[model samples]
Target: MNVSNATIEDVLNRLTNQTKLYFQRDNNTISVTATSPSTAQASPGQNKTVSGLITDATGEPIIGANIVEKGTTNGTVTDVDGNFTLQVSGNAVLQVSYIGYLAQEINTTDRTTIDITLAEDTQALDEVIVVGYGTARRSDLTGSISSVQGADLTSRSTQMLSTALQGQVAGVQVTRNSGGPGAQGTIRIRGVTTLSNNDPLVIVDGVPSSLNDVIAADVETMTVLKDAASAAIYGSRAAAGVILITTKRAKDRQFSFDYNYEYGIDRPTTRPTNGDVIDWMNVQNEVKWNDGASDPYSQYSQETIGSWLTNHAVDPYHYPNTDWMNLLLKKSTSHEQHMLSVTGGTEKLRTKSTFNYQKGDGYYESKSYERIAGRVNNDYLVNDWLRTNIDLDFSKSNAISPSQINPISHAYLASPYYPVQWEDGRYADTKDGENPLAALRLGGTNRQNYYKFGGKAQIDLTPLEGLTLTAIYAPRFAFTKGKKFTRAVPLYYENGSMTYMAAHRTTNLEETRND
Candidate 1:
């Protein structure tokens, strides 16, 4: 067993002379078979199974390694213990591959059991990464840059690209300014640089565009330009930083279709839940007494205080203690999104088309946002000398909000002792008090619609090898329309009936902006 100087011939001769065994040469190894004085085996079309363990050079199990027959789709991946079971025809060759490892092809002739060790592919370590104007190998980069793939973006439950970017990159700060649905998050690269708008310049497919216009599912990659050296090409607008977003495109001469739907709910982390009616009355009385007010019960009688504590809906609307926050704000708001895309190509032409729709409700009633967007991109090669590209995108968005006051702020500040409405179904009002519930009921709506459209065309003429002519033209248009209407609301009440004595006022406004 310890014969170190023995040759292959000696070993084979000893094995043949000692036992009824025969050896044959595999690619780089030895295969052993028993010598039987009987009939030969059957044909190669019969079904058989091949099982083994795949590992690395260090003999550690390589989970999820792909094992398949040579020229077909029959394949299986390794299990947790690097064990694989593959069913194939007799004497089939097995091809194995894993990420970051070199692939191997093993011959399965007259052998059903074997182990494989794949060497690490060192060349992949210097893989090329996309940059601002082009690409560079990771080892050849001198500036700071971060890249994220589209698959990572689509996995998040977000309506806009900005919100999905949170925590996805280093040296980037992303924050949601408010808890309003469909609100875009604020992003600062390498911190703020100025007192004015410190937003980074966003470049979509080589044109300046807003993140709201680009759907998360339509993005192919996002690259952040962090340092001055990496952003200098963009001038003043790039003082903070720059973001380059590339949309998806057809990669080969095959057709593909994708559909994705996401539905979720958003709720406020904390709501303004002050004390109940009885607790509120008691605390107000204590405050009045502490401030040297003589008559603590001057505002209401003991009977009224007991009625408030009992919460008897006797008159239904006359004497009520309304939980304004609960009445005005919903516990959770619904959100939904849908996206569809088609991609196909030939060697001469390639096309990708996408459509996306989104709708979400705000925390407050009657507050919501809706949007629909579509994009189409095409590229054509008119022989090897000339090529052309076309990209078109359009989006329409509508938002609705309360005209007068934000419901959340009113819910926290207004008193909750008064009823939202009177017995005759009239809006409740007080002379000196502002009813949050009344404000919600009487306030009008402000609506705004945004229309964005952009298109670009480029042609390349490769007349010579190192010198070529290029022509490009891009046009963008945006229009916004807003409408607001307000009506005079009773300010306050006297006695049991409403009694605010003010002149009725009405106003109508319409605004339009274009760029």
Candidate 2:
């Protein structure tokens, strides 16, 4: 059947004609009469059920609370299950009282179901201070080994494990000359350990390594070996102190998996300040002013300064004032990072695996980095006397550089009057000054590639009761390969660039056994 829309009057007429009336609820009070002497109906009571579960603020369950119908002296209490049920006489109130839980009172009405959630009393919920190593009553710790744990490392997309450690660990220092996945950070433990070799020894899963490829998400703990007792295990490499990095491995009898993702833009924390730029400009003017001229800016007469200011500052857009620094820096597009982890184990064998990917724009022009990595940590009980452990880590990365060219020379020595490009727009440069941008463009994406693997295995043989022999093996590798360029410019004209364009990689390995 076809139907047409109707106006308000038409809808009202149809409803009035077709609608039927029914019995209405009487505005009457419930009778207290039992109605019969043999089979009697009970009257409504004064109290209502105060049904609630008692729990601590941390969501932990609480048990054994006294619950009863108040004034009538009739009520039941919560059992070991932290739950209670009760019935009260007419108009009786209910009181819920518990030693560890706050006491609550409620009035009864014409209600069937009443539920309550009780909170822990102040005396029971008092704060308990924490002590590291093993929880002592905060008042017991005498030694100092600061603990740092809070912000989620998985949320931070730094490609290197060490990068995430910055500022979080006190007395432990991480220094990086530039940004990139494999750009090594000079790590020192509790200040410099030795006058000479200051770099602390890196230990992966309790085994020493000259180069350990660590994925940020896989790292669970970083402990600095400050004193002699901690350093004794490492021996020679420990002379400069020790850096122990522990990866997240599987726990026996439990199976777990997690996938975390984050997308964020990252750049320099502190850029070249305004004061730095001013100082640089002063140095440049002084360099030109030293050439027998009493005053600089003579090429553009002093009269031009007032006019330049009036025109530019009065209406900025109308008369442009060039700010090279602002033009050179901008917030690039947001970066994206994703990670997947799987860990599980049996009593005999435990295993862990993690995969991470990250990409972000670099601070300078034509710069960025992308990395993909996979790590597996495993433990196996070969026999009661024999056990083995292994951690395999591998990462591949590509870093995009602005130019392998001389950035400093182009930036510092380039003539302020000439600028980076002339009015003609062709790339401009001098014999002494070269644009770092050009050098970077020439080299393109010069990558610092890395392929790191750490393996550890041990054997334990019991020659007698409580007497055993152990053998261990570990190996590590790291490679930093890329092109660094410097053209014949104002800075590198003749004797200027001997130390420029120096790119070298360092690698190391370690192994041990005892009987």
Candidate 3:
């Protein structure tokens, strides 16, 4: 109380006991300001060292748990003993996370030591799964069933829905029927059951369907019933297995618009390796000599072989050492997908709609696939006792491939000495009359077009508690059109003259199916 004889420092210290204040002296001019409790406890820009131990809910030390300062990249991981020390700024927050465990955040204000216990993430086990004719929680199901989310399927960037299921579900083996664009894979659930068809029966939105008729982006969840007990509802039809596909639907009283686009490049994992023309000529001569020929270079003279080796580099077009695989197949093919979704409605009526377009190029020329698909789902609640639902989906796809022969096989067998094209841009002849480049570029196309339209409608009436009557009507229509055309490809000499017709043949076929 008697500050007249005390210095400024002593006076301030005595006054701080009764009321917290901040004082600043500028060359003997003293200024004081009132301060809050929090400001008096910690100063700005001050840092302190904090240490913590992380453990699981059962009090077991959790090794390798990550601890990070909130809003900063400064972070550290727990040691083998589950202990971590970190330097953090005043009033800093620490975020602790680990796999299969819930994350925790702790404030380090007025504290030097902290301990955390993480809880197990039971979200996956508590998820609701669609089974046979109804839905049940995963923990409640005893049968062998696996579920894959729609997001997981789309992340793989596969064109066919069957291809997206590869390696995602346990005990489910998916093998591609072909490498061409828009090709579907064979899905064998629990291995082969019969000698005939091993294809699993696919059900989309409670209706029998094909995987090709569904789009990955439009799926909500995929459930596979592996054992007979889980798929007994379908009887003998589920002999192989049963796959249930649920499409996305609108939520009540929510409005959202989403657009997604993906672009990717597909490259062959391996390519055929061929030697240069000189090596090929030497091998040919050796083969003839081994076959008891008097002159090894009878067909390919030594002088001609030497001329090719000398001029091949200078005049590659005429005396070319062609790599037929590289010439026929592109380095990389491109594929893209576009999706637009709209979801909006009131409490009484909800609706969801999606439109998708996908285009992909094959590794070989004259090979590609394109598809356009659209879906609409609507739910209406007439009253608490009555409800109605409707779903509509349509897709059109076109696949173009080389007709008649397999160009990839031909490329492996074709000679490396022949030029892909002569100086005059005419196809050159091969030893086997199978010029892969000519077949890829000049060959006719085999085109297949598929169109599908499907609709599902349902009505429900509830007359009493826990008692409801339901009726459903589902109809699907599919049409497929295929056309194959093959024509002759002429082989020309180096001087731009037609040497001979390279096994040319004319064939035309067209087929159409509706179901």
Error of model 1, residue 404, in angstroms: 1.3
Candidate whose TM-score is highest: 3
Residue 327 displacement in candidate 1 (angstroms): 0.8
lDDT (C-alpha) at residue 262 in model 2: 84
Q: Stretches of candidate 1 above 4 Å error?
A: 1-127, 269-272, 289-307, 311-319, 430-433, 463-470, 491-505
Instruction: Give the Å shift of residue 38 in candidate 2.
Output: 43
User: Judged by lDDT, which candidate is best?
Assistant: 3
Query: lDDT for model 2, on a 0 to 1 scale?
Result: 0.56
TM-score of candidate 2 relative to the true fold: 0.56
Flag the better candidate by lDDT, 1 or 3. 3
Tell me the TM-score of each prediction against the true structure: 0.73, 0.56, 0.77
* Residue 344 in candidate 1, Cα distance off native in Å: 2.3
What's the lDDT for all of these models?
0.80, 0.56, 0.85
420 in model 1: Cα distance from truth in Å? 1.2
